[model samples]
Target: MEAKKNPRVDIYRLKNVFFNFGLMISISVVFAVFQYKTYENATVLDLGSLNKTTNEIIEIPPTTQPPPPPPKIQLPKIIEVANEELILEDLDLKLDIEMNEDTKIEQVTFEEDLETEPPEEEADKIFMIVEQDAAPVGGIKAFYAYVGDQLTDNYPTAAARMNIEGVVYIQFVVEKDGSITQVQAVKGIGGGCDELAIEVVKNSPKWNPAKQRGRAVRSRKVIPIRFILRQK
Candidate 1:
């Protein structure tokens, strides 16, 4: 019989495996002991004192602060206006008041339009008709001569060119002060003669004013201004 082959000859090569398995078993045993073992040194806390109540009852008082006041708005101090009855209401006070002296102000009076009244001298200033009619500064012939000479530049060329021959009647207010004013055409001969006649009369010099009861007065004067053209 050959020497009995050592069947466990390779067991030495697996010795590291056995060693690792032994290390795992030791770790497992330590974990099992730590998980199952009880310690006598644990401190026990009693919660019975938390449930116990004293005889005193706590009471919370209601809030004592008042609500805040409304915000204030800043406005202009003085406001001026035309004469009118203005009612002012004071928001801070409960009453409506008028502006016065004790609240400190002066008196005010109303006035009328000054232009409506005229002076005494100008009261009988204008009259449409008087006792004596107003005359030009010169006699009738001299007045026509002056009119023709003054109207040399403002001649009715349109009427002359068209051979318009007719008389233009003009009306005017000869003022009390001998001034010729308010000259207007009564009956017009067209073709520019109407406006020309009126314009010529408007530029006439002062006249001898009309007389009413021995006093110089305004008078309505009507005159026939001729616009005769010569045939060429």
Candidate 2:
């Protein structure tokens, strides 16, 4: 038995053409997916006004103040008075004449005693060098012993801390009455040493007054005080 078919309406004849068309459409879709570009919605800020600069010229008004008033003047008062006549008397001024070589002029003596009593000698005059130099009440060694005893406890803290060692020269006045006066440091190495030396000398016992021409006199004396730090 032979099967009969229509040749013009055959579907199997276009199979290759339909396959190629489907392949080309798949390739175009893949290319379009890879090359796709998307736009984003962004807002831009306007900063042109912030970047612009303007210079302004301002005017300041001057202050207006009134001047101060002048000082008030005072006028003197006038008074009325009665007129009076003045009477003046004549005076006689005659000096007696007495002038001769042997007329014996009496000596004029002052009732208030104008002799001026020789200026009552200056009491505070101090002598630099005297016949006898002033000495401490005890001998020099004993005086130094007392000073050493006092200074053992009176060492300056600053001087001790820094190990400061030096001699302080002090000048003082010995009065006529065996009293010490005007004790001062002539030269010193600082650090509270000068002041401490002055204090110790001021508290020392009175010294034997100096003598000049067999009379007790005020005199100046200079002494050196050594500050030595001992090892602990």
Candidate 3:
């Protein structure tokens, strides 16, 4: 016979042990009992409507409106005519058609006040393009030569530094008395050339006055002068 181990030891030595089966069965039974007790004794709310509702009744008074007035009816207009028997036939209806001799309308006359005003004297006018252009003592070429000479004397220092070169056209008026007036530059190239050109023209000698219709007249003129820089 094999030697027998201790009965307590043999009892505890299970070959295929179900270690947690007892604990699991106990837990499952407790959980099922808890669920059943909860189902049996739970405080369930009916939540069913009691139908206890209060209705608010509002009484609206009838509108106190005034009745509309009746529509207006227009009656037709009637004209009365004179009766045949009541009409007057022999009654004397005379209209005096006579002129009064005392009503006299004399011929009316309006005497106007006569005013005599002295006439205004005619103004002497300056012409833009005269019938005959004004000239220098010589001619246009001579005039340009004179202007060139003047500009050469007073050549602008700035123009020389920048080597500026262009033509400067100047405008002025020749008076009827052979005098130059209102000199100004019409176009310019920069660098003090404009002023220099204007000064040269202003200092020029008087030109022969222009003629219009064979008579001496004041005239306006524009002349161009060249400003050239020569390289040595």
The candidate scoring highest on TM-score is 2
lDDT of each: 0.79, 0.87, 0.82
Residues 111-139, candidate 1, lDDT per residue (tens digit)? Answer: 97868744334435666666777888877
Off by over 4 Å in 2: 1-121
Residue pairs in collision within model 3: none
**Candidate 2 total steric clashes:** 0
TM-score comparison, 1 vs 3, better candidate: 3
| Rank order (by TM-score, best first) | 2, 3, 1
RMSD per prediction, one decimal? 26.6, 15.2, 12.4
**TM-score of each prediction:** 0.44, 0.48, 0.46
lDDT score, candidate 2, position 110: 65
lDDT of 1: 0.79
- Candidate 2 is scored at a TM of 0.48
Candidate 3 runs further than 4 Å off: 1-124
lDDT per residue as tens, model 3, 107-214: 998886567444432346778877888998788788788887877777888999999999988898998888889999999897999998888888787789988767
